[model samples]
Target: MTVPAATEGTANRPAPRQNKRNKPTGVDILVLVLTIVGAIAIAFPFLLILINSFKSPADYNSTGPLSFPGSLYLDGIVNFWERVNFPEKLWNSIWISGTVAVFAVVISVLNAFAIGIGRIRGNTWVVLAFLLANLLPQEALLYPLYNMFKAVGLYNNPWSVVIIFTVIQSAFGTYLLASVFGTFPKEVLEAAALDGASRWTTLWRVIVPISRPTLSVLLIFFFIWTWNEFLIPLTFLVDNSTQTVPVAISVLQGDRLMDVTTTSASALLGVIPTLIFFLIFQRTLTRGITAGAVK
Candidate 1:
């Protein structure tokens, strides 16, 4: 019935001390401050755009860029949308960017497979060629491209922009993916080969499944890049109905002067779709980043 000396003392021991509020260290406070400032820095532009997007010219003139609007104004947005033929522009962008993303990823996969996994002779030169191609300025190619497309009767066509960007974007993708595939687990490739998988079969069923995250990230990047591309799209898609959002926005600016609010609304509309796309696939991008860090 009697407790041991150690057990008896345990019953009488002071209750575990409650957690105390620890004042943040200087380092912690500095980090907190930096994070707040960084967030505000990043978010301020979007906030400004959203605020000004809702302001009428009168409200914006009265209060300026920093101030919030007194009343919501949807007119600028609606007017810009209609004026720009936004629905057509939106569809054009989606089609071009989507097509470029898919084509670029597929081209990249094929190129990377040849240079990296296949370890074909002269792959270093091939990869270097890809890198150099990416470094080549769009400006340098413009006149030549224009002449070529015009000769082919494809000038001012959306497909011209599509073809140009698909090649351009895939060049970068090939360079990046070749490096990734160069470090691919050799064991897996050997396993697939040992299983009597043909080279084509191994690439699609084995390599692609493993590389999906990276390809997803590349696809998203290619889509966003193509969506935001101005020069080629503007050059190749002269008609209002064929223009992408960026080209339309630029055309809107050059063709007429815009009051601050209308300009802000136009910019906001341009930014929202890509921002939404990024947010949607952000987690996949994160995974792709870390996939290399671990097994």
Candidate 2:
């Protein structure tokens, strides 16, 4: 009886697993190794820039691009500040980017919402207008708009740049937001209306909350675009104090050519804020994009 019971227990045991299928093929292993190498290759420039940013300009210029500086120094930073007035430039960039992003997002959102839900007259025409704005080359409008601004006494003002930037940014932003707003479940919105929510309330409490991901993506992209903007600032603002980082970098050249070391350091410095912005919003940016796509 004891032997029979032991045999039954042994029969109930599972078979041993196969190691063959769990192992990677030679090709698979090679692909993984190549992928790692490719990623490193892509990342090398950023690593080089970051490391070189801490070096003194003299040390950086003396060393090969791949070599480390003998002594880390703030000379590059000091030169960057004196040459560019970096603080003022950075502040101007921040202010302009923030203002443009806010107005663009708000105007785009409201326009999108109205077109998406209002069932108003000339909706198709409004969309067509947005498309036309996008189709026109910005350069074509530059001369005409410059003239218009001159007539209106706006050509050299920051307000001119701000308004133009907002309008230019709004075209694409409106299109993107309108697409997002269109994807919202009409049934849910109808239900909210039936529950006695006003259009403003439904928009603020319902649509906006559900649309966070799309909005996040738009905010990050818009801010980055505004921050890097150069031509518009150059066209509008003549004051040195009001120049954004990109314009400042352009003028980093003295009477002759730009100082290579100082300009390199300034270029490196210019990359920092955009990098910080991306890092801060990366998680939301990814999640929002994924959610928007799914919607």
Candidate 3:
């Protein structure tokens, strides 16, 4: 009844056809190639900026924009930093963006909790209003906000930008948080209630802790948006000392447009905070974005 040794050996051998099926197909190869090319296309501009920022003014002018520098030159960066008052503007950007992120996340969390978990009367209408407001373009509110801030004597103040960005960014944050909170487990909330936890206690002790991923995403978004905001900061923070990095960089570029190396250096410096922030929080950001998509 025993099988022959040759037949048994053949049966134990792995199938070459099955292994061949597991190899990447032609479509996968095509996608890999396209992805590599697309990434290079997207990254080339930033690479160009970083390289040329190190070039001397003469080299930058004489050489093609994308060409490698003949020698490492850092004078442009030094001059750009000093001429733009980078330290002061960087501090201004830090405080303004930080304030906006904190206020936006806190306010959005409370609003989302009330609308999503509280299930209060008229919650639907409130969410609808927020969604609609988020759809409105910034240009629509710019002049009105300007006049209001001016009338209140808040114009040319950093708080003015803070308030405007906080309000605008909170609208979207509220929408996102509402979705996340709405999906929160009912059993957990009920258990907390049975344990005599007040709504505020439950929120602080249970909800906020669980919602950290989504809140982190909101915080990063608000910070980056506030940091990069130009129009409101330009209109409201007119004073030279109060201007944020983006506005300061814009002014520097205008005054030194002929100096490509200097302008590029200033622009590159302005981009650093956002780049660093994103790189640091990229994992949490990906999780937060995908959280709402799932149960």
Candidate 4:
């Protein structure tokens, strides 16, 4: 009995129970691998374009699209800026996109509030109508929209493009915000009402603050789409002076490496703001899309 009472040494002590944290499942590892591969696949093209933007014309031609340029050259950048009237175009695009985003967000927010608060009766039908409208191909509506815009004397005007993009994009934004709003707690609205808050007061003071993620998503999407828009602007604004960056880039034509370099540089400049916007609002963008997909 005395021998059996010997104390255990530190090394002889049983190991502490393993932490309860679960290891990554096989499915998780598979998903992680797929996500990495998919991300690299999508990013490679942009990486190539960015690298090529800095290359000399000769280096660009001799190198593969995926290859690194031998050295950076300002010639491509210089030509892109000079030929495209980059400053003017950039300023114009800023105004166009900014205005569109402002108007779209304003209108969409109002729409979302109306539906989300039950002010708009038959909201489901309204949402369905918008979905149906978007389902129809753009080509189907071009002639009709053009005829109407022309009839209204909006042709060759920047406003024509701005207004068109706002209206066309509203359908998707409305759907997006509506879905986001659906995930909101109904009890909060009831509690506000019980606290003697008016509908407008509750929305402004409570709902809007909580809805930041969704609103940020809408703002960024509308901004990028309007900023990079080409077809609508081209169709509406026939004059070269009103050409958007995408349409302007298309005019850089020549059967030479220099021309290609110029085009790539112009494209790089055009895409810079979109990158900035996404980087700024990326958190909301991810959360917004995932809100309804999960519990």
Quick one: best lDDT, which candidate? 1
Q: Which ten residues in a row have the lowest lDDT in candidate 4?
A: 251-260
Model 4 residue 212 CA deviation (Å) reads: 1.5
The CA lDDT of each predicted structure is 0.92, 0.82, 0.89, 0.77
Taking all chains together, each candidate's TM-score versus the true structure is 0.90, 0.85, 0.90, 0.82
> What are the clashing pairs of model 4?
none
Q: Model 2, stretches more than 4 Å misplaced?
A: 1-38, 56-62, 254-258
Q: In angstroms, how far off is 181's CA in candidate 1?
A: 1.0
Model 1, range 213-257, lDDT digits (tens) per residue? 889889999999999888888888887788899999999999999
**Tens digits of lDDT, candidate 3, 1-295:** 9999999999999878643457798999999999999999999989999999999978877986989999999998999788878999999999999999999999999999999999989888899999999999888888999899889999888888889888888999888788778889999999999999999999999999988877888899899988888877887888889999999988777765647887778888989988998999999899987874575
lDDT of 4 by residue, 209-255 (tens): 87766677777778888887777776876665777777677655432
For candidate 1, give the lDDT.
Answer: 0.92
lDDT of 4 at 80: 80
Candidate 2 Cα deviation (angstroms), residue 96? 0.5
Candidate number that wins on lDDT, 3 or 4? 3
